[model samples]
Target: MDDEPEVVEAELVEDDRLPAIAEDRSPAVLLAEEDPDAWLPPEAEEDVQAGIPKDTSRAYKGDMDRFAEWCETVGRRVMPAAPQTVTAYMSYLKRTPREKTGRPYGPNSMDRIIASIRSSHRAAGFEPPDTMGARKVVAGYREQLALAKDPAAQPRKATPADRRVLHQALARLDRTTLVGKRDAALMLLGHALASRGSELAPLDWPGSFTELPEGGFRVRVYRKKRKKWQNVEVLPDPELEMCTVTAVRDLVEALAREGHTSGPLFMRIDQWGYMGVEMTRNGEPIGDPTGRISVNGASDVVSRSIARTGLPGDWRSHSLRRGFVKSARDAGVDIVDIGRHGGWDDQSKALIGYVDEEDSSGERNPLAQIGKAAMKKRGDGGE
Candidate 1:
């Protein structure tokens, strides 16, 4: 948001500081710790207003909200936070219920919240908070996470799929109908592009996926992290059953019949598992349009695919994107190329197992290092 959240100009945190321990005065801040455009000069105070990217603002709020909630529970102030309080907050987070997974947060998820808290504090005009103690807290959490990372300890998010596994998941669906065709197309293109479920339903026929003279599709991608649009090419597959080209072509035609030609490529299918441009009751369009499939709905497609095929109980929405990295890395593709294809500026952020400890340098792709063979194998399978 352009405007900063209002805060009391006077710091209300002196009373909130955790009591200092006399025995070990060695100081260490636990977690590393925004503004409006108008009164502040535009360029100099850019960080004050547009400091955080718009796409991530929701995440920023979520992190701070979580932190704020914890602080409230312990009767501490959120702003001008104390080193001890931050440490305590991390501990609280660790203690919270964490689904089938034993730990509340992964190292990466914890780091994201930590960064968000720091950013929020800075945006509020606080000093750059010392993070001396955060290293220990995060390290501790990481160690705990490592111990519990086994398949039994953590269900492990829909395990990344290899070509055979991916196609096998695809094989569970019935491709003759609209829902089948759309799901098939979604998974095929989604894996080929290494896209998140959130990115799939927003794709436009004419805008995002454009027809190319030579055959296949040119998919324009709006990256969530980068907040920029770029095109990725999908060539015609030699195999017809699972070809990205044919799958999408059939979907586009099917959607066109349903009056969804110009907008979102993936639309909500109704009770009979039919795609309709609007919510229809007794064949009549009703209320607001519910045609655009939600991220959750798209995710269910993957989950259902896994369930029907009996692939694995832990498999969920992230399988395809994660699979992209695992498949590419297994193929020994270059890291930089992978980053470019995956739209990740930070190659180190790719799915963890895709690279072992020796290769975990922050310089590889999170997904695409270039290999359509896996996706092609998927596209050729008849669901």
Candidate 2:
């Protein structure tokens, strides 16, 4: 995602030089009581009223808000933005300390913030201000920054866990509970499919997860990266206790017993074990899954499953996907096959060396290999 827009891992403190707004002034009161400014024409107003994609809209609004705050700090006009104003904002983003870290925004993040600003300006019917050649400023800074860094002292990436760490996490799940069973299946399928949290979060049962021959199953997912629904197969584990199929089977039957056969595959469960229902407050069939989990919720569930396992503090929903890649590479699976799971582009150097052009076998799907490897390791008595 290029990390899904400048995620602001660093902190930029508010400039103390700026005047402080009164704490008692409510934002709604200020906006409502303020004098009338320029207003949008009907069609433009209608376009704004029409629904927008939630993700991009949030991102754009966030970028604009940050830009406004920065403008206020520097005494610049935000709406009729000048090129010099854009340049100053970009400079601040690059030089300002991020969050608690003294480090400034990274090149990838800086580019996204600039893109967000550009999009907002264009949407407002103005050409992007050409200060520092507008977009070219970011390009110039990236090149200059690249040259400034000592090539050998590259930032260290988070330590990625291997298959054993994953197996240990999976073992910690208490399979006696229905929620536990669902968690087990979720871990396996997420790894097996090499899926993203966005893909895993909104899954609809009886549709997204389909049955296959011989107790195996094929997962159909709509991945944002792929721009369409795609299917990846998960082979049943002969070791009944750990098989993804068995876990899902149990979870499905349990949910169906509560009169749920459709809607989100991963529904939120209350502490008392209450799940989503098709009925409303009046207690009638509503014909849908009553509750849905969020992307962050999906990550939280995975974290809770492994909380006691002591693998690492940073284990996340994406941990399963990374574990799949590491496990596959350790098993000598080709790079080409790895990219095939979610149609990930292989041209990036990140997928190199471990990839084999001619290493085709019965195990074309490396995700399945994760189960096989984890099972083998567990069978070897905590190897």
Candidate 3:
């Protein structure tokens, strides 16, 4: 027999250009991490901590920590940092590629990192560094990306999970499995509510979600964009198989059988079908056993559901929200109504952009219509 060709697998090598965490941290971060009593009394500390949302607070801390580590490597002061040092940091972040993605930080991400650095300085009772230079550099970076025709220059939009995708995903799901039931509920609720993964992750059964006297349910959610709570109604769909209420009902009943009455509406499940529990890895707790699934987990549900649906374009958690908007717009739903249901300000440019883009395609396109009219005239020998 002929010798088979040697098969070799390609492995991704870690990008050494990516910065590493340093042992030393900024003095302000050290003070913040050491002890709350050292800075403020217990009562005052509690009030101070409550001022910022938990997610924002965690993000700020993480960003600052990374900045502090970078400062240590460069032998620069993080707190009371000079504008030049800040500019240097921004430049470094812009040029350095991430180990996993092999891409430099995008402009929006860099902006948030800069904001975090400023917040850390303000919290430490120091004047924030002047970032005019850094801002200009970021603007120049955007221009460079535009010149290079880099897709990163534009915002990445998720593929909308239209009816076809939803139908395929729903049909393929094994409703008998616990994971399948949960995935069904997650996908339905995500699409019906037009909710972000972050908003959907913290739902508490019978607390945030409640049954209505009329069919379907009412879900009260805190809109992060609006910084206020909004009540949204979900009516039963005409199609029983695609109804959000039915999906939720089935998932809740299945969960009750497992002795989980209330907590996070969506939760993690293991390969063996056991619900996620308090667990540790490397002596650090993985996640709160009493808490619901993480934002990423909610996204995973959407992605997993649609993976085998043979759809085109990139899909993620945001796909459900975008899908709702696109589907509603296609049905000739008013832009204002769509924005209201989606928890977006009626005047929001982001929301309007979606509507405007959808309006420009197919028969709605002015150029396309003109082309068709000209063709008809030519065919009639009138041109």
Please identify which of the two predictions, 1 or 2, would achieve the higher TM-score against the true structure.
Answer: 1
**What lDDT tens digits, residue by residue, belong to model 2 across residues 230-263?**
7888888776665777777788888888788988
CA lDDT of every candidate = 0.63, 0.63, 0.75
Name the candidate, 1 or 2, with the larger lDDT value.
1
Best of the two (1, 3) by TM-score: 3
What's the residue-level lDDT of 275 in candidate 1?
A: 66
Which model, 2 or 3, shows the larger TM-score?
3
Summing lDDT over every window of 10 consecutive residues in candidate 3, give the lowest-scoring window: 1-10
What overall lDDT, based on C-alpha atoms, would model 2 receive against the true structure? 0.63
Query: Which pairs of residues have clashing backbones in candidate 2?
Result: 10-98, 10-99, 11-98, 11-99, 335-355
- How displaced is residue 103 in candidate 3, in Å? 3.4
lDDT of 3 at 302: 79
Candidates ranked by lDDT: 3, 1, 2
Scored by lDDT, the top model is 3
Summarize candidate 1's per-residue lDDT along 135-156 as a digit string, tens digits.
Answer: 4687787777668773322323
Q: Rank the candidates by TM-score, best first.
A: 3, 1, 2
- Which number leads on TM-score? 3
